[model samples]
Target: MKLDEAKQKFVHSWGVLGSNWGINKTMAQIHALLLVSEEPLSTEDVMEYLKISRGNANMNLRGLMDWGIVSKEIKIGERKDFFKADKDIWEVARRITEERSKREVEPIIKILKEVKNVEDDSDKAKEFVETIENLESFTSKLDGIVKKFVKSDEHWFYKNMVKLIK
Candidate 1:
């Protein structure tokens, strides 16, 4: 297939993947575009390529920046602001994992810790407390694993993963 067709397919696939990961489709599409780009792209360039409105492009670009995957670039002698995605896939994965762990896992762990304390002496209350404790334990472990993965080097992680799968 042509390069343009391949890029389009990749962008669409990434958008779908982002949606599955609880991110906006357009935001992922923008990231895909920037990822494949040889140089940074301006907001107008992104809007033109994606056929999106200026506001949409700007908003998604900002969202990508907020996620710490995309960054703003200032080109010399250029009036428009340009955007670029972090080209290192490993760093991208680590950042996303760290952010999700903080946003999702940390909150669940905190809530579980708070709710696991049940003062009632009844059987149902005991069961409830036990269940909460189990959940808290599991989530805490998961959070720990995620934290380790985020901090580990790519080679070490892949080697350990290979060993586990073997």
Candidate 2:
């Protein structure tokens, strides 16, 4: 494939992958673009290249910044703001995992804990409580694992995980 074609394919694929990970396609595309860029990109550049409205580009750029994967750059003697991706794959994965766990897992765990605290004596209620308790237990464990993974460097975590599996 031609180089441009390959880059387009990568951007599209990354957009699709982002949807699976709970981010919008445009946000992923913007991130993908920034990732491959040799230099920081301005909002106008993003709008023109992606053929997206200025609003769409701006919003997703801000979203990327919030996710800690992209950041703004201000050049000297220029007023326009440029953006760039973190570029380190390990750090990128770590940030995504940490953000997702905080945003999704923590809320689910909180809801499950509340459900487990309900007062009821019926058989169905008892079963509901038991099921919720189990879910809470599993989620708490998963949260701990995610926390550990986020805290440890990637190499150490993967190495220990491999050792434990064996």
Candidate 3:
């Protein structure tokens, strides 16, 4: 494929993956644009590139910044701010992982852990409580392992995960 085609394919695939990972399509497209662009992009650039509204651009930019995946750059003599992606793959993946864990997993796990502590063991409740406790313990351990694992270098994280899987 030609360079332009390749880039288009990448942006499309990345946008789809981003959707599955809890980000909207235009936001992912904007990020993909920044990822492949040779230079930082201004808010207007992103809005034009993705054909999104200014409000949409601003909101997604803030969301990206919150996840530490994008940052604003100040250029000399330019009143407008430009945005750039986290070019490092590991950092990008790690930040996404951390954000997803905090946004999606933490609350469900907290509720499960709390359920495990409920004191209503009368035969049916006994089984319910026992099962919940087991699941809570298992998920808690897994969450801890994820926390520890994400802190490691990508190579180390993969090595440890491979060994644990084996």
**Count of clashes in candidate 3:** 0
Worst 10 residues of 2 by lDDT: 113-122
Can you write out model 1's per-residue Cα lDDT over 1-166, one digit (the tens) per residue? Answer: 9999999999989999989989889998999999999999999999998999999999999988988999999999999999999999999999999999989999999999999788899999999999999999999999989999999999999999999999
Which one is best on TM-score? Answer: 1
- For model 2, residues 1-166, the per-residue Cα lDDT tens digits are 9988988898889899988878899999999999988899999999988899999999999999999999999999989999999999889989999999989999999899877877879999999999999999999999999998889897898899899999
Candidate 1: misplaced stretches above 4 Å? Answer: none
Candidate 2, residue 147: lDDT:
91
* Candidate 3 segments exceeding 4 Å error: 162-166
- Cα lDDT tens digits for candidate 3, 1-166: 9988887788878889889867898788888988998899999998886688999999999988998999999999999999999999888888888787888768878898777665775888888888888887887787787687579898898897799899
- Give lDDT per model, in order: 0.94, 0.93, 0.85
What CA RMSD would candidate 2 show? 1.2
Cα distance off (Å), candidate 3, residue 110: 1.8
The regions of model 2 sitting more than 4 angstroms off are: none
- The lDDT, on a scale of 0 to 1, for candidate 2 is 0.93
